[model samples]
Target: MRTLITIVAFLSFGLLSEIQAQEKHEILSPQEFCDKMKSDDVQIIDVRTPKEYKNGHIKNSTLINFFDDDFKEQLSKLPEDKKILVYCRSGNRSGKASEILENLGYKNIYDLKGGMLLWEKAKTDCY
Candidate 1:
Protein backbone atom coordinates (compact mmCIF):
# COMPACT_ATOMS: atom_id res chain seq x y z
CA MET A 1 0.00 0.00 0.00
CA ARG A 2 2.80 2.43 0.84
CA THR A 3 4.56 1.61 -2.43
CA LEU A 4 1.35 2.19 -4.35
CA ILE A 5 0.85 5.52 -2.60
CA THR A 6 4.39 6.59 -3.43
CA ILE A 7 3.90 5.70 -7.08
CA VAL A 8 0.67 7.68 -7.23
CA ALA A 9 2.28 10.67 -5.60
CA PHE A 10 5.20 10.61 -8.03
CA LEU A 11 2.94 10.37 -11.03
CA SER A 12 0.75 13.17 -9.77
CA PHE A 13 3.73 15.45 -9.23
CA GLY A 14 5.11 14.69 -12.66
CA LEU A 15 1.77 15.36 -14.30
CA LEU A 16 1.39 18.63 -12.45
CA SER A 17 4.86 19.73 -13.48
CA GLU A 18 4.16 18.85 -17.09
CA ILE A 19 0.97 20.86 -17.07
CA GLN A 20 2.68 23.88 -15.53
CA ALA A 21 5.47 23.71 -18.07
CA GLN A 22 2.98 23.53 -20.89
CA GLU A 23 0.97 26.43 -19.50
CA LYS A 24 3.90 28.82 -19.23
CA HIS A 25 3.64 32.03 -21.24
CA GLU A 26 5.56 32.49 -24.47
CA ILE A 27 8.64 34.66 -23.99
CA LEU A 28 9.19 37.41 -26.56
CA SER A 29 12.43 39.22 -27.24
CA PRO A 30 12.73 42.95 -26.72
CA GLN A 31 12.58 43.75 -30.45
CA GLU A 32 9.71 41.38 -31.03
CA PHE A 33 7.66 43.10 -28.32
CA CYS A 34 8.72 46.48 -29.72
CA ASP A 35 7.54 45.62 -33.20
CA LYS A 36 4.22 44.39 -31.90
CA MET A 37 3.79 47.53 -29.79
CA LYS A 38 4.12 49.69 -32.88
CA SER A 39 0.88 48.36 -34.24
CA ASP A 40 -2.32 50.21 -33.47
CA ASP A 41 -4.57 49.08 -30.60
CA VAL A 42 -1.76 47.37 -28.70
CA GLN A 43 -1.88 47.73 -24.93
CA ILE A 44 1.42 47.97 -23.02
CA ILE A 45 1.04 46.91 -19.40
CA ASP A 46 3.65 47.24 -16.68
CA VAL A 47 3.01 44.40 -14.26
CA ARG A 48 5.50 45.69 -11.71
CA THR A 49 4.42 47.13 -8.39
CA PRO A 50 3.52 50.80 -8.12
CA LYS A 51 6.87 51.60 -6.59
CA GLU A 52 8.71 49.93 -9.43
CA TYR A 53 6.45 51.64 -11.92
CA LYS A 54 7.18 55.01 -10.32
CA ASN A 55 10.89 54.28 -10.68
CA GLY A 56 10.59 53.82 -14.48
CA HIS A 57 8.51 52.09 -17.13
CA ILE A 58 7.99 51.90 -20.86
CA LYS A 59 6.54 55.00 -22.42
CA ASN A 60 2.76 55.06 -22.70
CA SER A 61 2.49 51.84 -20.70
CA THR A 62 -0.24 51.49 -18.09
CA LEU A 63 0.31 50.01 -14.63
CA ILE A 64 -1.65 46.96 -13.47
CA ASN A 65 0.50 45.40 -10.82
CA PHE A 66 0.49 41.63 -10.77
CA PHE A 67 1.00 41.59 -6.99
CA ASP A 68 -1.48 44.26 -6.03
CA ASP A 69 -4.28 43.31 -3.65
CA ASP A 70 -6.77 44.58 -6.22
CA PHE A 71 -4.93 43.12 -9.18
CA LYS A 72 -7.98 41.47 -10.72
CA GLU A 73 -10.03 44.62 -10.27
CA GLN A 74 -7.38 46.73 -12.01
CA LEU A 75 -6.90 44.18 -14.73
CA SER A 76 -10.59 44.27 -15.48
CA LYS A 77 -10.18 47.82 -16.76
CA LEU A 78 -7.88 46.78 -19.59
CA PRO A 79 -9.61 46.61 -22.97
CA GLU A 80 -10.14 42.97 -23.79
CA ASP A 81 -10.16 43.65 -27.51
CA LYS A 82 -6.53 44.68 -27.77
CA LYS A 83 -3.27 42.77 -27.72
CA ILE A 84 -1.61 43.06 -24.30
CA LEU A 85 2.17 43.45 -24.01
CA VAL A 86 3.14 42.88 -20.37
CA TYR A 87 6.49 43.34 -18.67
CA CYS A 88 8.01 43.42 -15.18
CA ARG A 89 11.42 44.03 -13.57
CA SER A 90 12.91 40.59 -14.32
CA GLY A 91 10.24 38.76 -16.36
CA ASN A 92 9.16 36.43 -13.52
CA ARG A 93 6.05 38.35 -12.49
CA SER A 94 5.20 39.26 -16.06
CA GLY A 95 5.33 35.60 -17.07
CA LYS A 96 2.88 34.76 -14.31
CA ALA A 97 0.76 37.76 -15.21
CA SER A 98 0.64 36.71 -18.86
CA GLU A 99 -0.63 33.29 -17.80
CA ILE A 100 -3.32 34.97 -15.71
CA LEU A 101 -4.22 37.19 -18.63
CA GLU A 102 -4.56 34.17 -20.87
CA ASN A 103 -6.79 32.44 -18.34
CA LEU A 104 -8.89 35.62 -18.30
CA GLY A 105 -9.76 35.07 -21.99
CA TYR A 106 -7.19 37.39 -23.45
CA LYS A 107 -6.33 36.19 -26.94
CA ASN A 108 -3.20 38.18 -27.66
CA ILE A 109 -1.06 38.16 -24.52
CA TYR A 110 2.70 38.80 -24.73
CA ASP A 111 5.55 38.37 -22.23
CA LEU A 112 8.72 40.40 -22.32
CA LYS A 113 11.51 37.78 -22.64
CA GLY A 114 13.92 39.13 -20.08
CA GLY A 115 11.39 41.53 -18.69
CA MET A 116 12.43 45.18 -18.31
CA LEU A 117 15.94 44.03 -17.50
CA LEU A 118 16.50 42.93 -21.07
CA TRP A 119 14.65 45.97 -22.35
CA GLU A 120 17.06 48.19 -20.47
CA LYS A 121 19.96 46.10 -21.70
CA ALA A 122 18.79 46.67 -25.27
CA LYS A 123 18.88 50.37 -24.48
CA THR A 124 15.25 50.80 -25.34
CA ASP A 125 13.82 54.15 -24.33
CA CYS A 126 11.36 54.23 -21.43
CA TYR A 127 9.43 56.85 -19.57
Candidate 2:
Protein backbone atom coordinates (compact mmCIF):
# COMPACT_ATOMS: atom_id res chain seq x y z
CA MET A 1 0.00 0.00 0.00
CA ARG A 2 2.89 2.34 0.74
CA THR A 3 4.48 1.61 -2.65
CA LEU A 4 1.17 2.16 -4.41
CA ILE A 5 0.76 5.55 -2.72
CA THR A 6 4.27 6.59 -3.77
CA ILE A 7 3.62 5.53 -7.36
CA VAL A 8 0.44 7.56 -7.52
CA ALA A 9 2.17 10.61 -6.11
CA PHE A 10 4.98 10.31 -8.65
CA LEU A 11 2.53 9.96 -11.52
CA SER A 12 0.58 13.01 -10.35
CA PHE A 13 3.75 15.07 -10.20
CA GLY A 14 4.70 14.07 -13.72
CA LEU A 15 1.26 14.98 -15.05
CA LEU A 16 1.33 18.36 -13.37
CA SER A 17 4.76 19.10 -14.80
CA GLU A 18 3.58 18.23 -18.31
CA ILE A 19 0.58 20.55 -18.02
CA GLN A 20 2.76 23.40 -16.77
CA ALA A 21 5.16 22.91 -19.63
CA GLN A 22 2.36 22.98 -22.20
CA GLU A 23 1.05 26.21 -20.77
CA LYS A 24 4.19 27.98 -21.93
CA HIS A 25 3.15 27.57 -25.56
CA GLU A 26 0.50 29.86 -27.06
CA ILE A 27 -1.45 30.43 -30.26
CA LEU A 28 -1.54 34.03 -31.39
CA SER A 29 -3.59 35.87 -33.99
CA PRO A 30 -1.94 37.73 -36.85
CA GLN A 31 -2.20 41.05 -35.07
CA GLU A 32 -0.90 39.61 -31.86
CA PHE A 33 1.88 37.90 -33.74
CA CYS A 34 2.79 41.17 -35.41
CA ASP A 35 2.81 42.94 -32.09
CA LYS A 36 5.09 40.33 -30.61
CA MET A 37 7.39 40.56 -33.62
CA LYS A 38 8.26 44.11 -32.60
CA SER A 39 10.06 42.79 -29.57
CA ASP A 40 13.78 42.34 -30.10
CA ASP A 41 13.83 39.08 -28.13
CA VAL A 42 11.46 37.32 -30.56
CA GLN A 43 12.78 34.96 -33.24
CA ILE A 44 10.47 34.32 -36.19
CA ILE A 45 10.58 30.95 -37.91
CA ASP A 46 8.96 29.99 -41.23
CA VAL A 47 8.29 26.25 -41.39
CA ARG A 48 7.19 26.08 -45.02
CA THR A 49 8.93 24.43 -47.96
CA PRO A 50 11.70 26.26 -49.82
CA LYS A 51 9.54 26.75 -52.87
CA GLU A 52 6.61 27.99 -50.83
CA TYR A 53 8.88 30.28 -48.84
CA LYS A 54 10.20 31.72 -52.09
CA ASN A 55 6.71 32.91 -52.95
CA GLY A 56 6.69 35.01 -49.78
CA HIS A 57 7.15 35.00 -46.01
CA ILE A 58 7.34 37.31 -43.06
CA LYS A 59 10.12 39.83 -43.20
CA ASN A 60 13.34 38.90 -41.43
CA SER A 61 11.99 35.46 -40.51
CA THR A 62 14.29 32.41 -40.63
CA LEU A 63 13.41 29.60 -43.00
CA ILE A 64 13.24 26.14 -41.48
CA ASN A 65 11.47 23.65 -43.72
CA PHE A 66 9.02 21.59 -41.69
CA PHE A 67 9.33 18.62 -44.05
CA ASP A 68 13.11 18.46 -43.83
CA ASP A 69 14.70 15.54 -41.99
CA ASP A 70 16.71 18.03 -39.93
CA PHE A 71 13.65 20.00 -38.81
CA LYS A 72 13.91 19.07 -35.15
CA GLU A 73 17.70 19.26 -35.25
CA GLN A 74 17.54 22.78 -36.64
CA LEU A 75 14.96 23.83 -34.07
CA SER A 76 17.20 22.43 -31.34
CA LYS A 77 19.82 25.01 -32.29
CA LEU A 78 17.57 27.98 -31.46
CA PRO A 79 18.18 29.87 -28.25
CA GLU A 80 15.75 28.49 -25.69
CA ASP A 81 15.78 31.70 -23.68
CA LYS A 82 14.33 33.76 -26.51
CA LYS A 83 10.71 33.85 -27.63
CA ILE A 84 10.05 31.67 -30.71
CA LEU A 85 7.35 32.56 -33.24
CA VAL A 86 6.53 29.79 -35.72
CA TYR A 87 4.25 29.74 -38.79
CA CYS A 88 3.64 27.86 -42.05
CA ARG A 89 1.47 28.01 -45.22
CA SER A 90 -1.70 27.24 -43.27
CA GLY A 91 -2.02 26.50 -39.56
CA ASN A 92 -1.36 22.76 -39.72
CA ARG A 93 2.41 22.62 -40.08
CA SER A 94 3.05 25.39 -37.60
CA GLY A 95 0.74 23.70 -35.10
CA LYS A 96 2.77 20.52 -35.37
CA ALA A 97 6.03 22.43 -35.19
CA SER A 98 4.87 24.22 -32.07
CA GLU A 99 4.22 20.85 -30.41
CA ILE A 100 7.74 19.78 -31.27
CA LEU A 101 9.11 23.00 -29.83
CA GLU A 102 7.10 22.56 -26.68
CA ASN A 103 8.33 18.97 -26.32
CA LEU A 104 11.88 20.22 -26.81
CA GLY A 105 11.45 22.39 -23.70
CA TYR A 106 11.00 25.77 -25.34
CA LYS A 107 9.44 27.92 -22.64
CA ASN A 108 8.08 30.74 -24.82
CA ILE A 109 6.71 29.39 -28.08
CA TYR A 110 4.08 31.28 -30.11
CA ASP A 111 2.36 29.72 -33.11
CA LEU A 112 0.44 31.85 -35.61
CA LYS A 113 -3.26 30.99 -35.28
CA GLY A 114 -3.98 30.64 -38.98
CA GLY A 115 -0.52 30.85 -40.51
CA MET A 116 0.15 32.84 -43.69
CA LEU A 117 -3.25 32.19 -45.15
CA LEU A 118 -5.01 34.09 -42.42
CA TRP A 119 -2.19 36.56 -42.17
CA GLU A 120 -2.75 37.52 -45.79
CA LYS A 121 -6.50 37.50 -45.41
CA ALA A 122 -6.17 39.84 -42.48
CA LYS A 123 -4.05 42.19 -44.63
CA THR A 124 -0.97 41.69 -42.53
CA ASP A 125 2.06 42.74 -44.49
CA CYS A 126 4.39 40.02 -45.77
CA TYR A 127 7.78 40.11 -47.41
Question: Who wins the lDDT comparison?
Answer: 2
Q: Tens digits of per-residue lDDT for model 2 on 45-116?
A: 999999999998998899999999999999999998789999998889999998898888887899999899
Total clashes for model 2? 0
Q: Put down candidate 1 lDDT per residue, 1-127, tens digits, no spaces.
A: 9999999999999999998766635678998888888889899999898899998888889998787888877776789888889999998988878878777767678899988888988854332
Candidate No. with top TM-score = 2
Which pairs clash in the backbone of model 1? Answer: none
CA shift at 29, candidate 1, in angstroms? Answer: 0.3
**Model 2 off-target regions past 4 Å?**
1-21, 124-127
lDDT of 2 at 12: 100
